[model samples]
Target: MAPNLSQAIERIDAAHSEDPTKVDIDGEPTPYELIYAKKMSKFLELHTPNPDPLLATAARAQHFRRWEVPRDSYPRTKPGYFAWRTFLKKRQADQVRQLCLDCNYSEAEADKVAALVAKEDLKKGEGKGDADAQIIEDVACLVFLDDQFDEFEKGHDEEKIIGILQKTWVKMGKRGQDLALQMDLSDRAKELVGKALAG
Candidate 1:
């Protein structure tokens, strides 16, 4: 079973104790600060210098914030969701690319990683499936996109990036359509699509 909030908090507290000065709460020690500090420390220890501390923190916060929000509260409008997802994807891709480069991966290898990360398999099957598999796929795709984007910037073909994005959008959009087709979602989905098309 997964650890509850209390257990997770305790673990974070213990990790924070290793670097008391890093912990902060309203300018003093706080649980949030402790967790951040420990996370940064662990990241630095395990990974080479590529994913900047600030970037990693920002990406992590953005990713988790989405998870924290109730599913029902997710933005249903096309433009709204599109913009939000774009922001997240860009950040995730950038971070993963940096990590791949730092690890001495070649440009081709990195692009492959980014393509894998940008995949939209999560939009399938009522959004229900193997949790671990989904997580692995997400990470892989993100890393692939990150690497690919980096390569594109360094004189690689822009068309390749565009093609990848186009294909990914189609796949993701199809899944969205599938989700919208569910008996329970037809009305809301139609409304969202109408709004999206109008916008």
Candidate 2:
């Protein structure tokens, strides 16, 4: 990694260190969003060993300071969920854009990073799916499936779980879908996923 990119990632992690929520990763107590960002980068690396600098930066800062936007700030219903997600996407993208600029990235590179962070033109961009956008989607979907699915499933109903799974599946490429199927989900989660795929 370039020193500037490493510095950007480190600064992002430092901001996330303020989060109170913690999770154990391989027996180490890791801050929530910090670990999430790390997982996202790792998944992106696994998806494409030779990722562009902009794509890598976008992935590493996807959830930049996510804890600052508490989910409870919105309504508890689906509309609220959508609103929160939409707001967070913009916020994260903006934060990443500034971070990239601070890292000495050109405006073109910052714009590309922002677009990926916001997941722009995911399925329809370029009229045939943008490859970089798809890579961003695939990495995020894989990270959620591999690391966050269990906790996510615990709070949602089966119908909601299935709906989310279907949406996530659609965002993924064939490789990501294949990897998702091989994840070690609990039996209930697996059943819900199977039903979602079938439906």
Candidate 3:
């Protein structure tokens, strides 16, 4: 990685390290967002042959300070959910953009990372965005599926789990789907994914 990109990722990790939520990682209590950021970077590395620096930075900062914007802060209704998500995308993008600038990245480069974080380059449906944007989306979906799906499904009804899996499946391209199939998911998760696909 270039020096600026390395510095950018370091800065993002520093921000992630402040998340108050903790998760057990190999018996060590680690900040949840820091683990999440690392997972994003790992998934992106697997999905893309050679990931761009801006895209890598965007991946690392995808959920930057996400705990500060709790979902419960908004109403539980669908419109409220959309509003919250929209706000988060904009807020994360703007903050990460400024961080990139602080790392000496050019305005255009920083803006590209912000756009990736905001998902502005995506169109509705799979394979409908620019390569970089689509890869970023894929990386995110991959991380969620690989790292969060097991626990996430435990909290929802089967119908809800299947519904969420279906929605997540559509967001991925062929490469992502292929990688997902190869993941070492638990048997239950595989069954849920099968049901989601069959539905």
lDDT of 2 by residue, 1-199 (tens): 2327777777777887877889887998878888888888888888889787888888888777778888999999999999999999999898888888888888888888898999887876226667888898898988888788888898988888999999888778887887778877778778888999999
Q: Which candidate tops lDDT?
A: 3
For model 3, what is the C-alpha lDDT against the true structure? Answer: 0.89
> 1 or 3, which is superior by lDDT?
3
Ranking by TM-score: 3, 2, 1
Per-residue accuracy of model 1 over 1-199 as CA lDDT, tens digit each: 2213233234334533544234445786654434543443343333324543322322222222223233345477877677667665565445444544444545554444343334323447466643322433333233333323344434635444455544433433332333323424234333443444344
Query: Where's the lowest-lDDT run of ten residues in candidate 2?
Result: 121-130
Which stretches of model 3 miss by more than 4 angstroms?
1-3, 125-127
What global local distance difference test value does model 1 have? 0.40
Residue 87's lDDT within candidate 3 is 97
Off by over 4 Å in 1: 1-78, 112-123, 126-133, 137-199
TM-score for all models, in order of appearance: 0.28, 0.88, 0.95
Cα error, candidate 1, residue 158 (Å): 46
- Please give the range of 10 consecutive residues that has the lowest summed lDDT in model 1: 57-66
Please state every model's RMSD to the true fold in angstroms: 16.7, 2.5, 1.8
Question: Which candidate ranks first by TM-score, i.e. highest?
Answer: 3
User: Which sequence of candidate numbers ranks them by lDDT, best first?
Assistant: 3, 2, 1
Off by over 4 Å in 2: 1-3, 26-28, 125-127
